[model samples]
Target: MSLRRLLLVAIALTFSFLSSFVLATPLHIIAAENFYADVAKQVGGEYVSVSSILSNPDDNPHLFEASPTIAKSIAQAKIAIYSGIGYDSWMSKLLAGHSHLTIIDVASLIGRQDGDNPHIWYDPHTMLTFALAIKQQLIRLDPAHQASYQHNWQQFVASMHPILTDIDSLRQRYAGTEVTATEPVFGYMFAELGFKVRNLGFQMAVMNDTEPSISQMKGLHNDLIEHKVAFLLYNLQVSDPMTEQLKTLAQTHKVAIVGATETMPKGIHYQQWLKQELDAVQKVLKK
Candidate 1:
């Protein structure tokens, strides 16, 4: 073959290989909440592009309304994740008509039903299960990347070991200990630590943004004022007059107040977020 012809043939083969690599585009993944988006990213790695619909730590997630841009994103995504059981119902509405997308409802994935706390991600198991689910879904969606997904998922699961150890240590020392929260945002974590959560009715009412019966208010107030609970868990993203009143009482009575946010803060991944919260718990308990 002539030298020029041989060089041209080699160039054509290289172009074909490059075109094939470009064809394996990253999957578009949308998560209703930021933490789930972080998990999807951890498991999906370079194979996926993830978006979090509700990512602000200061915004009250209960009052969130979907924007047109968010809706369009969900419609075009290859996988959509939401905390089902009513946490982000707007996601369910936005996800409709896209039957081709894979949906991961963390609540239903773990057998939780409506009326259960929507913040199931607070439990380590919930996130681990979610990571595994994302891995499987990605494997099915792109079998070519199955090994990558499996390795990433394993690392994600292993990263939670320290958090699990913290949970066990807390449970050993504070199991059956009395605690209270302004809402149920950290209820699952409390359960994992085996604490007896007090004034749950008050919490549910606050979470739903409804009036907790005067008696419910009085019950929580009395718990705080009387120091019946070891610490008060308040939602940092959400606070009302009622929440403030209880927070004041907690402080005055010397009961520690632990603030928990509804969404993961920016620049911090899910694992770091959980570790910080667990550290706060340990701090309050040791006080």
Candidate 2:
């Protein structure tokens, strides 16, 4: 072949190979909690490679310590997600130097403040919001897969319809039903279902790692013993002697208990996790 023709052919082949490789590369996503990771996966589908920092159900998110490995992952990620408002504050510090990353703070997206309950995943709407944000960011990051991202977002939104319907159905059927929690982990869901949550002081204290006031403790005990609360949504991820005592009191009074978690448990999708918890609540109400 002529030298000029050979050079042109080689350049064309090189460009083609580079284009294919770039197209096949998935967007790297890092979520502080598994639930957010799960949502990003659902929304990004095969176009993303997701990693979750907090995947264990037993770990306390409040006590999360960021390591060099985690910092490296954050630095490498094209997209990052975390619940702000003090839930995963460490993530913010780690993310500070990674200004190039597209950080999605769920608390900030949902306008939740510092004192607000940070378990934003329990609220279906929060996931919906995050899913949309993920979709937008993915589209921006990989415009070639814009259609795929949109389709995934639509499917995710469609999937939540049943959960929303279930919430409405439960609210209509059991609105004003009394419920309590060891912590406010599932408070948003409880409120959405129209359950009258008692012992706010107690829940806040436990969530903040402070001791509940004597009156708050007395109120929680009385509510369980008197059957004033129909169920106790306990934070199974964390437990001290005090929370364990409350659990015993609930069991003694026959108050149904549903365990809630800060992170999405292993072997479950985000939608499944929410549905399972809602189903648990419904079962308690049925009983």
lDDT, model 2: 0.89
Local distance difference test, each candidate: 0.90, 0.89
Worst window of 10 by summed lDDT in candidate 1: 237-246
Q: Write the per-residue lDDT of candidate 2 for residues 1-287, one digit (tens) a residue.
A: 99999999999999999999886878899999998899899989998999999987878889989888988888779998998999888987889978789989899898999888878788899999999999999998899899999999999999999999999999999999988889898988988898899999898988888888999999999999999988888887887888798899899888888887777789989889889888988887787
Which regions of candidate 2 are displaced past 4 Å? 1-23
Q: Which ten contiguous residues of candidate 2 have the minimum total lDDT?
A: 234-243
Error of 2 at 73 (Å): 1.2
lDDT of 1 by residue, 203-282 (tens): 89878878889998888889888889889998888767777887888888888999988899899999999999999989
